[model samples]
Target chain A: MLYLQVLINGILLGGLYSCIAVGFSLVWGVLNIINIMHGSLIILGAYAAYFAFTLLGINPFVFVPIAGVALFVLGYALQAGVINRVMGAPVLITLTLTFGLNLILENAMIFAFKADYRKVIIDPPLGLIEIGSAFVPRDRLYAMLLALLLVGGLYAVLRTTRIGRAIVAVRMDREAAALMGVNVPRIYAITFGLGALMAGSAGSLMSVIFPISPLTSVAFLGKAFVICVLGGLGSIPGVMVGGIALGVLESFGSLWLGPDYSTTIAFVLLLALLMFRPTGIMGKRGFE
Target chain B: MTGGRLLMAVAAAAMVGALPFMADNYILRIATSMLMYATLAMSWNFIGGFAGYPSFATAAFFGLGAYAGAVLQTKGVPMIAAWIVAGMIVTVFAAAVGRAILHLRGHYFAIASLVIADVLREVINGMTNLTGGGMGLNLPVLKIDVTTQAQFFYCAMLAVALLALATSVILDRSRVGFGLRCIEQNEDAALRLGIHTSRYKTIAFSLSSVYPALAGAVYASWVSYIDPAEAFDVLFSIKPIIMALLGGAGTIVGPVVGAFIFQVMEELVWRNFLNVHLGLLGLIVVLLILFLPKGLLGIGLLSPRGRPLTAKAP
Candidate 1:
């Protein structure tokens, strides 16, 4: 029964983890920039949702799209205005640039928010549902469902939409995509924007479950890095698999080794995966 | 080296050496920090600048050195011997770890190196009996007066910085240095030319690890306290890279020059805008990368023909 409960909790947490990594994976896949600012961007979305819930009397779930759209604009402007200028530089340059951006965003949040951890309390807190003697919290279930739905929406958009095809085209081959009349830089901006949107939406969902603070960005960023590598870089479905795997592993790991060692275990797993299978479980050769 | 430049270098060194006599405690402290960062920046240059490996393992080596030194000190080992022993331990550890991870290119290598510090911090935290875990560890305090102690650490850091500088000068002209440069330019071509790319890289990685380890040991002793969090702070890894980039990576004087200027700027910014100093630092980094990717040294003063040292083939 305990094992069953842990499994359910892992699955629920895994869904949100997938949502967190999708944007980061998309940007890394398409832009080839690690987007170190990603975790902070997610935090920004959480703050947005928190403020909306408190000030506007809106549920965080209802404010997800609003947060996403806001972050999408910010991400688009940043990539187009700042990051695109160094599009041709070495990988280290871009990585450092994003790191700088992350510092700015995170510090700005710290300055503004005073580094306090805040959470959105859904009024009349939703109770848990019992399934075969295992309890599933209603809020976590809702967050998981919403997160999966967003990921599914993203998949559908990528499969069917014109802009999504342009993003895919750009990812496959930038010069060729440009030759085929695609606005390559614009596509890159859109991809970054989409990534931020996903981060923001995930932030909105996460705000209810986890305490929101600027400091948590590092942990979130670390998880995203591990998940993206685990699922294989740039693969959407791979992120889902990787997220669930990590979620389950961490669940079992915390149970066995105590919660503090969970991060250490995840990092050890990352190092092992990086060493033994650089291509990751679901990643193809070229992507690695 | 040209006689004129050599004389100028000696003059600069003498002036820095005389700083303890002329400056107050605050200035002496800052100078010591500058030397410490200069050492870090130079150490980073071995692999990051010359070999083109973006390693973020500086904090890992540093924290390990601090712990090793702190632990040894607690065991009643003499301080200088502990520092040297810590350096050896980190050098061996880096060589082994470098061999394992050096094959990864670009982002993969960067991420792998970045995670090492985090892992080390966790491990150190878990070992409560030896490390003191989160509660922290204390080294035996020296019985000297405050001023003498300050002068001692400053001079010690200065000596280490000079040692690192001398090594950089030698490495910049050696055959292994040439091999590292070639590897940086094109690893595949360098390998095809019969160069031992992996060995050179591992050598560079090990070289980069040792000085920072020694500095970490010296720092642990100086502060008289050490902790997993303080020793393994990621900023220790990042700030040196920024300083290296700011000065001009891959050049003998670049990291030193960068460290000096960055330290001054940091002092100024930290004084004026304590609240937003980090954000301002980030803004500076963004502007620096966007406008001056080659750093201050890349502005055509150091190189012949007025070409930036890092300029790629057109």
Candidate 2:
């Protein structure tokens, strides 16, 4: 029964984890920038949702798209205005640039929000549902479903839409895509914006389950790294698999090793994956 | 080295050596910090600047050194011996880890290195008996007066910085240094040229690790307290990279010059904009990378074709 419960919990958590990594994976895959500001962007989304819920009396789930759109604009502006200037520089330069952006965003949040943890508390607590000796919280279940839906929508957009094909085209070969009349810089901006949108929505969903603070951005970023490495970089389905795997593993790890060791386990797993299979479970060779 | 350059070096060393005698405690402390950062920046130059590895493991090596020194001091080891032993321990550890991860290039290598400090922090936290977990640990306080102690640490840090500078000078002239530069330019070509890329990279990585370890040890002893959080602060890994980049990476004097300039800027920004210092630092980094990729030293030192004189044409 306990094992069943843990498995369920892990799967649910994995859904959220997938949501977190999906945006990061896309930007990294397409832009070839690690987007160190990703976690902070997610936090910004969470704050947007938190403020909306508190000030506007709106549910966080309802405010998810609003947060996503807001972040999309910010991400698009950042990539277009700032990051695109260094698009031709070394990987380290871009990474450092994003790191700087993260510092600015995180510190701004800290200055504005005073570093306090904020959460959107529902007026009536959403209770839990039991299935064959395991109980799952309603909020987590909704969060998971919403995450899956968003990921599915994104996957569909990539598969069917013109812009999606352009992103894919750009990712496969930038010069070729540019030669084919695709606006490479614009695609990069759109990809970054999409990534931020996903992060913002994930942040909105995460606020329901976890406390939102600027400090947790690093942890979120770390998890995204682990998941991306685990499932493979730049692959949507791979992120899903990786997220669930990490979720399940963390669930079991925390159960056995105590909660404090969960982070250590994740990092150890990341190092091992990086060493043994830098390509990740589903990643092809060149992505590494 | 030219006689003029050697003489300038000596004069600079003498000036730094005389700082403790001439400056107040606050200025002496800042000088000590500048030296520590100089050591860190120079150390980072070996792997990051010369070898082009973009390692973020500075905090890992530093925290390991601090804890190793602190734990040994608690066990009644003499302070200097502890610092030396800690350096050796971190050097060996870095060499091993470098061998394991150096094959990864670009972002993969960066992420792998970044995670090291986090893992070390967790490990240190778990070892409650030795590291006191998250509660922090205290080193034995020196019996000397405050001023003397500050001077002692200042001189100690200056020695480490000088050692790093000397090593950088030697590396710039050595075959191994040439090999590292080749590897940085193109690893595949360097490897094909029979330059033992792995060995050179590992050597660079270990070289980068040692001075930061020594600096960490000296820092642990100076502060008289060490915590896993403070020891493994990611800023320790980041600030040195910024310093190196702010001067001019891959040059002998770049990291040291950058460290001094960055320290002064940091002190100024921290004083005036305490609340937004981090944001300001970030702004500086963004602006620096965007507008001055060649660094402050590259200003007016361009070649006829406008490339930085020190940089090889890509």
Candidate 3:
């Protein structure tokens, strides 16, 4: 029963992580920027939700779309205005630029939020569902179901929608996509915006269960990178696969080793994956 | 390269050399901190700037050096001996890891190096017996008076920075330096041309670690205390990269110039704003990346006769 509960928890956590990582993977795949500022966007979304709920007395979950829309604008403008100029520079330049942006976002959060740990208080914070001998938290189940829905919905749109096809085409080859009548710069902006939207919503979902502060960004950033590498960098389905793998590994890692050592598990997993199979579990070659 | 310019540079060096005799203790201490960062930037430039590998393993080697020095000094080892031993240990470790990580290019290499730093921090934190389990270790305080102690460390850090500068200058003019540049331009092409790219990279990586290790050791002694958090500071790892990029990555004078500018600005920001300094620095770095990708030295306004540092062409 204990083992089963842990597995269920891992799966639920994995679902949330996949949603958190999808935006980052999307940005890295298309724009080829690591988007080190990603965690900040998520934190910003969480705070946005916090304020919306606290001030207007709405459910935190209800305000996710608004946060997502706000992040879309921020990410789009940032990509079009700043990141576009250095698209052709060395890879490190773009990475370092994102790092700088992260510093700004994180410190700005610190200045505004005062580093106090904050979490959203849903109307029913903890409701449990018992299945045989294992107990499932209702909130975590919602987070998992919402994660799958958003991720699955995004997957379906990419397969069916015109803009989604254009994003795919751009990801494969930017110049060729432009030659094929796609507005390459606009596509890049939309891709970044969409990624930010996913990150923002995921942030809202995470805030229901976890406390968030400015300092939490680093841990999130590391996990996003680990998942990106694990699930395979440009693959949509890879996000879910990588996220579950990390969640399970961390689950068992904390059970066997101490919980404090759980953070290093991702680094170890990341290093091992890069050394052995850089393409990742579901990642295709050339794209990675 | 002009004799007149060289003479002026020598005169400036002599002035800095003579500062401890005239300047107060506070000035000397701040100058030492600047020189310490200058050393870090210089060392980072060898691999990150010249070799074109964006590495974040600076804190790993730095923390190792600090720990090595702290342990040895506490065990009755002389300060100079402890510093030398720390440098040697870090060199070996850098050489080993560089071999594995140098194969991964672009962001793979960068991310892997970051993991190395984080992993080292965790390992150090976990070893409760040896590392004091985050409670931190304190070195035996030196017997000298405060003023004399300040001058001693100031001279020590200046010496290390000078040594790093000399190494950078020498490497800049050497065959290995040219090979590093070639590798940076395109590693495969450099290998095809028989430049021994991997060997060159490993050597550069080891060389870069040596100075930071020495600086870390001296820093441990100067502060008279060490901990995983303080010794392996992530900001310590980042500031060097920013300073190197700010000044000019591959040039000898660039890192020193960048470090001085950054240290002074940091002191001002830390004093006045206190809370938002990192945000301000981050904004400047973003602006610098957007507008001045080549950095201060690369733009060459300070270059003798207004010449660009070198042809940017690979």
Candidate 4:
């Protein structure tokens, strides 16, 4: 029963984890740059929802697309204006640029939000869902469902949309994509925008569940990095599988090793996986 | 070395040496931090600037040294002996870690290093009795007058900074620097040429560990307190990288100049805008990384284009 409960909880947590990982993985795989600002962007999305909810009285979940669109514009502008210039530089250079951007974004958020931990309480909590052998919170169940919807929607768009075809083509071969009349830079910008859209929506979902501060991005960024690596950099479905595995593993790790070791468990797993299997679950080898 | 440049070096050293005697405690304290930062930036240049490896392990080594010094001091060991032991321990540890992670390239190597810092901090935190966990540990304060105490640390750190500069200069002029440059340009070609790339990198890595470890030990002793957060702060890992980049990564004098300039800039921003100084710092790093990748020395120098100003220091 304990194992069963753990499995259920892990699966639930994994859903949200997949949401965080997929956007980061998409940006990394397509842009071929590690987006260190991913966590900050996620936080940006959360703050957007906070403002909309508090000031405009919009429902947090209803603010999802609004936040996503806002961040998409921001991400698109950043890539077009700055990251595009460093496209040909080494991976380290782009990564550091993103880190610089992260510092900027984080400090801005701290200035506006004042480093206080806040949560969007839906004003009287939602009831829990009782399964055959375990209980799950309503907010988490909603988060899981929304996560799947976004991931599935993203997968479908990439498979069917024309712009998505360009993104895929550019990801596979930038030079080839350019030679074939695809505007590689535009595609790159759009991909980053799409990534931010996903991250922002994920942030909205998270704000409803977790008490968030600007500082939480560091912790979340670490988690997202681990999950993205575990799932594979380019493979979209890899995130779901990787997220579930990490969630379950972390759950069990917490159960046995105490809570203090849970964070270490994620990083240890990341290192071990990077060393032994650089190609995660369904990922192509060598940072693909 | 050219006679003119040699005289300038002597003059600069004399000025720095005389600072503690003439300057007030505030000046001495700030200068001490400047020297410490300069040493750190120079050390980072060993692996980051020369080898072209993006290592984020600075905080890991520093935290290890700080804790090592603190623990040793608690056991009644002499401060200088503990600092030396800390450096030695850190050197061995860095070599082992470099051997393990140097094979991974790009983000793979970077993320691996990032994880190592976190792991080291956690390991230290878990050993509550040794590290005192979140509560932190205090060192034995030097039994001297406050001004003398400030001067003591000032001189000690200045020595480390000078040593780091000498090492950087020596490496820049030596075949080891050429080998590292070759590795940076093309690792595979360097390997094929029998340059023993890994050994050079590990040696550089270990050598780089010494200054940060020593600085961490001195910082712990001078401040009379040690904690995981302060010791293993991730900002420490990147600040030196920024400083080195701001000056000139591979140049002997770049990081020192970068450190001094960045320290002054940071002090100004921090004093005026306490709430958003970090944002300002971030803006500077971004601007520098984007606009001045070659650092202050990299722009068209009087000597020539593509040559850092310090190229003809001798």
lDDT of each: 0.91, 0.90, 0.85, 0.84
The Cα RMSD in angstroms, rounded to one decimal, for candidate 3 relative to the true structure is 2.1
Which of candidates 1 and 4 reaches a greater lDDT?
1
Instruction: Provide TM-scores for the models.
Output: 0.97, 0.97, 0.96, 0.96
lDDT of 1 by residue, A1-288 (tens): 999999999999999999999999899888888999999999999999999999998899999999999999999999999998888676778889999999999999999998999999998999999999899999999999999999888888887899988888888888898999999889889989999999999999999999999999999999999998999986788988988888899999999888988999999999998898887789963221
* Whole-model lDDT, model 2: 0.90
Off by over 4 Å in 3: A285-288, B304-314
Per-residue lDDT tens digits for candidate 2, residues B168-195, read 9899889999899888888999999899
TM-score of model 4 vs. true structure: 0.96
Candidate 3 interface RMS = 2.8
lDDT of 1: 0.91
Instruction: Report the C-alpha lDDT of model 1 over B1-314, residue by residue, as the tens digit.
Output: 67877797799878897899999999999999999999999999999999888899999999999999999999999999999999999999999999989999988999999999999999999899999999999999999999999999998888889889989989988999999989888899999999999999999999999999999999999999999999999999999999989888888888898999999998876779988988998998899899888988888656521122363421
Two-way DockQ contest, 1 vs 2, winner: 2
**Pick by DockQ: which candidate is best?**
2
**Candidate 4 per-residue lDDT over residues A117-161, each given as its tens digit:** 998878678889888878888988888899889988888888888
Question: Residue A190 error for model 4, in Å?
Answer: 1.0
- Separate clash counts for every candidate: 0, 0, 0, 0
